[model samples]
Target chain A: MKLLEDRIRQDGTIKPGNVLKVDQFLNHQCDVALFDQMGAEWATIFACKPIDKILTIEASGIGIACCVARHFGDVPVVFAKKSQSINLDGDQYVSKIYSYTKQREFPVIVSKRFLTAGEHVLLIDDFLANGKAMNGLIEICKEAGVVIEGIGIAIEKGFQEGGRELRAAGYDVQSLAIVKSMDPDQGTIEFA
Target chain B: MKLLEDRIRQDGTIKPGNVLKVDQFLNHQCDVALFDQMGAEWATIFACKPIDKILTIEASGIGIACCVARHFGDVPVVFAKKSQSINLDGDQYVSKIYSYTKQREFPVIVSKRFLTAGEHVLLIDDFLANGKAMNGLIEICKEAGVVIEGIGIAIEKGFQEGGRELRAAGYDVQSLAIVKSMDPDQGTIEFA
Candidate 1:
């Protein structure tokens, strides 16, 4: 986590609206080695839980989730689709996610065939801002009757309530780098 | 590539409208071990080229590109964004792509900072169908003045014009599994 925090400080950008742009190393342009390190950290923290699968929402979360699944002994990673595709058919576990970044509501869905009852699901994501996406994933898992093992995130906006809310709800949440605050003018970033 | 071909034959579903669904292992639910094999295979083919970065379209390609970047000495994997977000600002390399699957035109954008001029890029994707997505990615790389070393695909629909068009255009394309045809009723699949 220290390494991630350090990397964020070195490469992350602070924009208005409390956005920490780690896209240089984390999201858009990915550092696979750092992701591996982050994945190992997640594996270590959730080592006790029975993680049958790793679930994530598409685009941003897929890279980190893919990397993390390797440390979990190559566990299958199921990414909830943000956009409905012609490929995805039949019964699905669906939930509505409000994207604070995009400012819209989109349905994230996972095939009922992929997730089944009693399966232990580990929800993973790139950032937990308001926790809408995380909650959507959790909702899908709940609908599928899959046991929610824990939540793992590469980065968490600590100023946001999503992480706090999940923790308060008794869900184990682990964020690799938590941004406490950001100063755009000073180009400074504080991490938790 | 045999491992990939075998997995596809075993787990891939033949759907209507000439769709080969490897969603169980390739698209939706990902297999990290198989992806590692894929990365090794891609490395064997493209390692001789000067690949400074791996460029891929987002959603599906991010996972493979991230894993493949490891074999390329952890250079970096830059995935083009399909959707616009508040964080994506400043200079960008953008291209228009027509999605046959979704039946729409979507703009794929990559931050200009990521793909520098003269950067050798290897485009990685889960599938090469009509090659519209690959073409869009190639266009972005071109706009950025990055040299496209080659293209790597997990599955190539041989029946589609994408592979043929790229080959005719003198692009180096390596697909692990090339599907010749699919029969839905018999659940039969042919690979070239």
Candidate 2:
């Protein structure tokens, strides 16, 4: 995770309210090369676990999930859509999530056919803050009767309790870079 | 393309209202191996063009775009987000798009910083039907004054006017698999 930490320190922007923007290469504008490294790291970390599928939320998580899926021997990546679409009919495992970034609550849904019973699932995402999205995905996995193998994240806000809570709960959670602290006025970031 | 066509014929579900669900591999539950082939195909097709970046819409398009970017020598992949967030605060190029699948309209926004003038961009998407999403992406590129090399689509509804219109308008649009027609009752699909 040294590369990711360095990239964050170099390219990440600090703003008020604990915002660390790495849009240049992490989220909005993606760097596939960096993602490849992150994916390789995730694969190496979870090499022992049995991962049948990679689950993620829509928007930001898709790219990282796709990259990680390749590393996991091209496991199928199923992303939960933020809104229900006509195509996604039939039984679904839905969970409501509050987005601190957008400041809204939305239902994240996955077709029941995708995540079936007894499958080993690894949840992946771009950022982890309050862990609302991660919890929602975990809820969906539980409802589908899938075995939660682990969680992979590109960046984790160390100031937040999401990572700590998941670790305390005995989940195998791995984050590439963790921002321990940030100062908006000085534009400084400390890594954990 | 033959592989993709075969995948559709074998795994794709035909529903009423012209819905051909290939979510098992193409979108929701993505096949990174197939996407790698797609990325190679697009790279071969547009090898002559000077593409500085790969542009796409969020959610479904990000995975395909990331794969395509890898084939294009790991060019930056910039995705237009469907909603506004706290991180996206500066000058943005916004376009409204009507979603036939979701049956609603949403605004797609790209920060002006990621896409700049004089850069060559290629738009990639999972599906092209009414061309609203593609057009919205094109509008965002134009607003940023980026030169569009072309548009790459994994599946295009040939029965729909989107592909025809774009081709007629002299845009270099390439669709890997084009569904000429579909019958829900008979469970038949014809490719163009």
Give the number of the best model, judged by DockQ. 2
DockQ, per-model, please?
0.88, 0.90
True contacts kept of 2: 0.93
- Steric clash pairs (candidate 1): none
True contacts kept of each: 0.89, 0.93
TM-score for candidate 2 (chain B): 0.98
The per-prediction CA RMSD against the true structure, in angstroms, equals 1.0, 0.8
Instruction: Return the lDDT, model 1, position B153.
Output: 96
Candidate 1 TM-score to native: 0.98
lDDT of 2 at A65: 90
For every candidate, the chain B TM-score is 0.98, 0.98
Return the top candidate by TM-score: 2
The true-versus-predicted C-alpha distance at residue B73 of model 2, in Å, is 0.1
